[model samples]
Target: MVCRSVLLRSVAAAVLVASVSACSLWGGRAAKPVAAELGPNVAVLGVRQAWTARVGKIELPLELHVNGNVVTLASSDGVVAALDAKTGSDVWRAMLGEPLSTGPGSDGKTAAVVTRANALVALESGREKWRQQLPAQVFTPPLVAGGRVFVLSSDRSVAAYDGATGRRLWTQQRPGEPLVLRQAGVLLALGDTLVVGLSGRMVGMNPNTGVTQWELPLASPRGTNDVERLVELVGRVSRVGDSVCARAFQASVGCVNTARGAVAWTQVASGSEGIHGDDRAVFGTEGNGVVTAWSRVDGSRLWSMDRYKHRKLTAPLLLGRSIVFGDDSGTVHLVSRDDGAPLNRISTDGSGIAAAPAVASDTLVVVSRNGSVYGFRPD
Candidate 1:
């Protein structure tokens, strides 16, 4: 039950969470491994709090949408606001007056979010433009790109809608296991191709017509039961040119060459969070709070850091010379991008970080579970 509770706190949106045989997740409740002690804050990497804002508590997975210098974020209570990433000032805020499941994906102009009531609402400049009813529950943030709102529902269905009007464009459904992760799945635009994560495969689709272009499996289902075989790609992928590297739940991490529509490489990884990288290495956090860096060219281990083991870390953000991660203690960790060495740590509201840290216009922003939005700038 402790393992399940930790998972629930980390990925609160997980649906139909099945029973696990062992309590070995994140060090488990049996032994309860103690977290590593932090060293003195030497201020090796200079960072200062820029601004702070408030919103409703964010219990579900919320993917911060960055368009230019504006970042759009949503809380569980359906309070969607776009803030200037630099100053943490609100560009515009909208209250949907309903509980939201996921999102606040924006294209600098239009913002979109899905409510727990199965409604997709689009806002333009903080004004409600239109709202459309969805057939299935959605956990992935709607991709607002190219004048369209794309949604990947929990039932392994992909649908598109007009950004201006709530007109349905096309819906594509794929056969998948009945159990699906309610976390944010991969849904992004690769050039003109709509790269989506279906089950454990990264499928390329034509955004205009919703036609399948190419399909590459990153992981395959292999277990006795549905929960054991569950493999879905998470978000916050590392995209360098035509190559997009993503994680297949707790199975493996792989890169797909979108241009060639072929897999570059795949390495077995027991991490459940998404990955981030630049040109050299891809970085991810394992379930036990081990941070790993893998070579981007070939899926090989570059370095692994376990200093924060059992801390329940979120996915990382590759910012400048450091990779930033948030933990269950609401502390922001900055580690060396070249080596997984600790650099610095920043404290938050003590309510724990709700999601992965995001950066826009040189400003790093992290939202806490208590809905404290803090923006930091490198000094």
Candidate 2:
């Protein structure tokens, strides 16, 4: 069996265990490739670190919630904080006093997170609003929008709660592939439609009633074994108006016309992370750390860059004129979105970037694995 053992860890809800001698998750039996060497820092893009702050170590996949001038982020040890994007000053800070599995998803006013003990806790301004226990383990960050808290659990369940009172509004359970990924899944709001990723399909639901509106498959499961056939849609999708494009883990990348409930196009892409883009093109980092740009309209290859290959890169973030990516070496590379040319490189705390870089109020913020939050501004 490719998936030999299943262990529940603090980082992930469940981890896939494989053999060192057989085909592993990091591609095939080939040896790991060395990261590409970064040459001289051109620093053509004039940017400087604006400020820095500290939080608890971020071990889980916490989504940095950017709302206007404020960005809300959480640590694995249950420290949730809202920081001013420009000044890096704390707007408010709250400690949950436990290890969190995922979250700190906020809608500016209310923040939410899933604890390791399966409790969905909500906070307002810096105080606990309510806490509700979930039926299954949650890996995806709870979507706090439309005055409702939406959760996508590891067992492929979608539940909604009253954002204020933690009242159970409704729960929608769907049958899925036997094995669900322990990583963060897609749960976002597309106007009135509640967009969620269940297995390899993106399903649209009614936020008020939890009724299914439409479902579009991004990738089909293939291969003989369960591990080989895992095709779950990860988080951090690219949304351009009514069009949404996402990646089905290690399977394919596709765009969905949410307005029409139709697929624009899909191409086989061997990547595990989600994608980001503008109206013209979408960008993604492959499992080998090769960055790629695809035409948004037709899914054609726009360009590709291998300078960061094998570096274990996070998802690409299209910020202003530059495409931003955080690598395993605690380096944030700013490359040209048009051709992936080196623009600038910024160093973090040498503990690796914990999540994809986010921007708010013209300030770029990235969290390190050691809980250092660095904010940068264009100079």
Candidate 3:
């Protein structure tokens, strides 16, 4: 009897171990995170700076807008300053309460500033035109279209007001979660529809009444709950001929049809929060340190180059025929857009180039993580 009892206990222990192993295998571990890389034949040659300026001491410089000879900057500290685009000199300054969340939207003469306090302030000649308050904080940059200024709140509500009078025109609420984990969405004005990207989905609504024109699912990775990651939609909603292009960085790039709300194609490239395109091609930096180009028509992979090892790339900036982007290590890379080949590289004195470089005609403006703005152009 004693022998029988011991044998029974051993068999039970073996069964338990087998059950645990099966659970471990079925629950699949998360995939290893890929690091950034640099492409081959890339050379680091120093470039000359045209100008540098201190905009003031702020935690984050939210937006940079260039208008004629004037450059406007909004900070997270509720300060807006207009600077001379050529000389980096101050033109005017305005102080608003609460942090400036989105960049300032302007209609040449008037500026619409969205605040973290859910207020939109209209400014002209360094004076307040009007202020309209909403129920939630504003995240994406406000769009000034059709003689109206549109502001998107965190609650997925789009509000439009008369640009000159601040008169409420329409308030359309897009279907969104009660709790949004990330700002990885865009408010784009394309023709009659206002486009917004949510978690695993994209919806186009009529700007007039806030009715859904079409809705489509953007294919994300099977297990990624992108909303929970708080990933902001960093790419612009660029209008390519009749189609619109945008990129999100949950697990891949979901290029979609703007008119039909259908995905044209999806790519496995990651860390593509910033996307820019030309007449023939689209360019962006992948999460794994690869700069790539894809055909805009069919979504075919054109060419890719790995330049650095495990360096996070900034958004792709179009400079003439070359694409420019900076990494976390203060290295700026300029690549030929024709074939995805590296052309030139420069090192900034700051810690890292976190923000996208601003290209104004012949001058390039870049901000460092250490709160310094540097301008460069070809000599």
Against the reference, the lDDT scores of all candidates come to: 0.87, 0.87, 0.64
Candidate 3's TM-score reads 0.78
Whichever of 1 and 3 has more lDDT, that candidate is 1
True-vs-predicted CA distance for residue 322, candidate 2, Å: 0.4
Off by over 4 Å in 3: 1-47, 57-63, 177-184, 200-202, 220-234, 257-262
The RMSD of every model to the true structure, in order and in angstroms, is: 3.4, 2.9, 11.2
In candidate 2, position 325 carries an lDDT of 84
Span of 10 residues, lowest total lDDT, candidate 3: 13-22
As for TM-score, the candidate ahead, 1 or 2, is 2
What is the TM-score of each predicted model, taking all chains together?
Answer: 0.93, 0.94, 0.78
lDDT of 1 by residue, 1-379 (tens): 2456323321322344432223664556566567888768766898999999998999776888888899899999989999999889899999989999896788899999999888999999899999999887788899999999999987688999999898999999988875677679999998889999998999999999889999999999999966677888898799999999999988999998988879999999998789999888999999888999999999899999898998888999999889999998999999999887778899999999988999988889999999999999988
For model 2, the superposed segments whose C-alpha errors exceed 4 Å read 1-31
Which candidate, 1 or 3, has the higher TM-score? 1
lDDT of 2 at 74: 91
| Candidates sorted by TM-score, best first | 2, 1, 3
Count clashing residue pairs per candidate: 0, 0, 12
lDDT of 2 by residue, 152-222 (tens): 98878899999989999999888766677666889999899999998899999999988999999999888
Instruction: Quote the positional error of residue 177 for candidate 3 in Å.
Output: 4.4
